[model samples]
Target: MTTHKKIRKAVFPVAGLGTRFLPATKAIPKELLPIVDRPLIQYAVEEAREAGIEQMIFVTGRGKTAIVEHFDMAYELEATMSARGKDMSALDATRATPGDIITVRQQVPLGLGHAIWCARAIVGDEPFAILLPDEMMIGTPGCMAQMVEAYNAVGGNLISVLEVPREEVSSYGVIDPGATLENFGGALTEVRGLVEKPPVAEAPSNKIISGRYILQPEVMRTLENQEKGAGGEIQLTDAMARMIGTQPFHAVTFAGDRYDCGSKVGFVEATLALALAREDMGAEVRAMAERLLRA
Candidate 1:
């Protein structure tokens, strides 16, 4: 039996050029864009922390320095807040211990697979989780925590999945499932392969691969010489598909709803959803929303 090591590190691939949001994303890293008030990246980091992860590895690229600084200690800012006698507790969630945040330059505009590969040295031989900062996973226990629970039971590569309309499968990377892993009641499915955005007729399953993943270190070896797939870029799905069957790969269905903050529509949806959920803002926001709808 293969031993599954404890997952202590998480990789955040923030190297992508946010072309979709245009001028808004031009100067600001899309990961730093706010959903309500908190940035999208903070939500991802907090989720990883909830999963008991110690090391936070960020694969970043050009013009993304603000991301690293966001998680750092702002001595001057904190001191000013203290002098002003203002509550400074909120800054705690925004800061990380000096060594906890490790940023690696991706250098190139490669695909997700290449971006993940940049963190292999930092991830080393341990099993690590991957959370796309733009993909806001919202839930009580958080998606990463739920994925960690399922990983403990199965002990292999695991990716989060959720059902979508069959017709909508064309817009997502769907999973080719074999059977439901017993004991989890149907929450865990044995993933035979992955199909990236297939047409409704050819799509094998309606279960689309969401943003979170817990992968073993051996995947790094496969990615070392991985060939470019769709869009002539190293696709993470291709590498994962090759490892399926050879390793115990399963699709874990998390209870959280994933919000894609990478798109304009998703950004607005997430902002409204999260804003309305906030205790301080909920009532007023809901009233304003009702007024707007009525108007």
Candidate 2:
């Protein structure tokens, strides 16, 4: 029972209008927004790849063709790079080996659950993953990698979670703990229930769902007729909540930094943190930060 299931496919919901980002996002997808040198969606895809996911399914919208192309081969660009004998690392960031990707249009501004449902045909009967690109999780093993290990151990639905302050619980999907274990200097709790953005005073637990999830494909079927919840749009949390008691669900307390890059402030923070982590930019960032502090 401890054998790890090879979860080979992952669905990425990228259909949002990204209204939060305004005019800049008017043309460019917010998922294409760069954290440092890479787009937000690239970070999520890289995380899935690290977790052993072989196929990436992106649920996109009209303007999101760029997203599919971003992961696709740039033949002319590659030819130029090959001809120049250049490092080509820049081009490498945009290219995934052929046949590794699939893209479908969401066609409407629906909820997260709806976006996931759009990819149901390709996912089939296998257990799959859903990664929110806007939630950039940085770690040694990456967020999904850690969750995949936990999924192997638990053999059920798994959601990456982190303990947010009680006040912040209202801003996320909070988990109700049944039993807990400590590992890798972090806590893993057996989740009995989930409340989506519950009131601060009524939250069952302070642990909030971090973006990474290894969900049973049955959930996609459940979403087939799922009614709208929480803001009149299909809510993935609501669908996941219904799977309680039927499936073994747990909250994996991950060892990482979770950044909500969909917002203006969080995006800037990710940019600075990632830039400071890079060997090339670290020194410049340090000096400029110091100069800014002095000024």
Candidate 3:
């Protein structure tokens, strides 16, 4: 029997050149783009922290240094804010302890699997998580935290999934479910297999893989020999598919709203959705949205 080790580290694959956002992403990473006030990556980091993850391994690329600096203490800025009698509490969550964060560069633009493989040294031999910064999941207990609780009960490999429209299944990695679990708020499903970006007719099921993953370290080893799948680049889904029956793989259906911030429309929707949920801005934003819609 495989003894489940506690998941303490999470990998953030942020090496992608955000071609979708072009000029804006040319200088600033898409992960650092503000969803309202907080950057997209900050939400992922906070979710990981909430899930009992102690270490953060960022697989970064060129011009992504801003992400590193974002998590570090800005003494001068804090002092200035303090002198101005401004509240510094908002910045508290962004701070991290020294050495808690680790970064590795993926010099070549390989793929998602390759980006995660770059963090192999830091991940070592333990169960870890992979959170995509672009997938902004808004939930009460948090998505990753919910997955961590499920992982504690049944361990092996876990990935967050959502039921998408049948026609839209081709845009994601569709899952083949084995058995339905009775607990965890009825959001858990046993993963039988995974097909990456399959055609609508050939898709195994409507349940598509979302951004959050609690993967075993063994998948990294599998990725080392993984060949390119769909787009002539190493795909993470390909490696995970190989571990299907060998491990206790499951998919947790997320209970929150997910925003694919990788796309322009999705990013704007997430920003507005989050803004509308804030107590300070909800009513005003709602009224403004109604006026704009009416115009």
Candidate 4:
């Protein structure tokens, strides 16, 4: 097993305008939007932490300070809860050490690659992971953990991929795959090429790069000179594509459910799916679901 540098940090790009969310996001950052009770960003951070990521670097933008605050200590709320003798367990996930959670301002909505480049100083010269908060990954060991396990075996760039409808390939970074590594039981495959939101007709394959990634530090240098590709922005796909043949690049097909919380319908569907799986709400939610379906 090739031992790779530990993936101690994760970069979260939460600078989007959330225009699709409208008035709700007009005031609240979309990351702060809750799936059930906890915010979307919280889930993403927690997943990273569970995967042994020690540091969180959030690439923020204007009007995104709420995301930084969400991870900070709620002194007044904690005090009030303490006074009322209420369980503080629900707020436990929000607590972060003073410097453990760091934020860097992106200043512009350049693109995914630019947002990541903004955190170059923080990420430094080591391997790190990128987790998109809007994509809620639900699994027993977590999406990050699964990727980490695969990284331990291969020690290179590993991205999560899902087989999306061919027409939807234009909405995501499509992967052009080479031969599958049979040693990993066909779960891992060489990344032959990457296209950022390619035309459906020109797409290399139906598999889309899901939001999670284990990237190399060299990617920062590539993004520094990365020209805007698809969508007239510095797409991360272009940067990753440049690194494909130079180093080990593979994709992991996620073996769990992933909810695209960025969309209105996806958000509602994620809520119901997760709500029904919760121990406290399962029975009631299931009954409610059945009733609603009948009506």
Q: Tell me the lDDT of model 1 at 21.
A: 84
Cα lDDT tens digits for candidate 4, 13-119: 99998999998999899999999999999999999999999999998888999888887888899999999999999988898987879999989788999999999
Please give, for residues 1-295, the per-residue lDDT of candidate 3 as tens digits: 4457999999999988899999899899889999889999999999999889999999999999999999999999999999999999899989999887999999998899999999999999999999999989989789999999889989989999989989999888899988888866668899999988889999989998989999999999999999987789999999998999898999999989999999999999999999999999999999999999999
TM-score versus the correct structure, for each prediction: 0.97, 0.95, 0.97, 0.96
Ten-residue segment with the worst summed lDDT in candidate 4?
181-190
Q: Which candidate has the top score in lDDT? A: 3
Compose the digit string of candidate 2's lDDT tens values, residues 1-295: 4675679999999988899999989999999988878889999998999999999999989888999888888889888888999788877656777768999888876799999999998999889998999999999899899888888777789998998889889888899988776663455678899988899989998999988889998998889989998899998999999998899998888798988898899999989999999998899998998999999
Query: Any idea what lDDT model 2 has?
Result: 0.88
In angstroms, the error of model 4 at 82 is 1.4
Per-residue lDDT of model 1, residues 167-255, tens digit only: 79999999999899778878999998899999999999999999899998999999999999999999999999989989899998878
Candidate 4 — what's its lDDT? 0.92
The reply for model 3, stretches above 4 Å from the true place, is 1-3
For every model shown, the clashing-pair count is 0, 0, 0, 0
Deviation from truth (RMSD, Å), model 2: 1.5
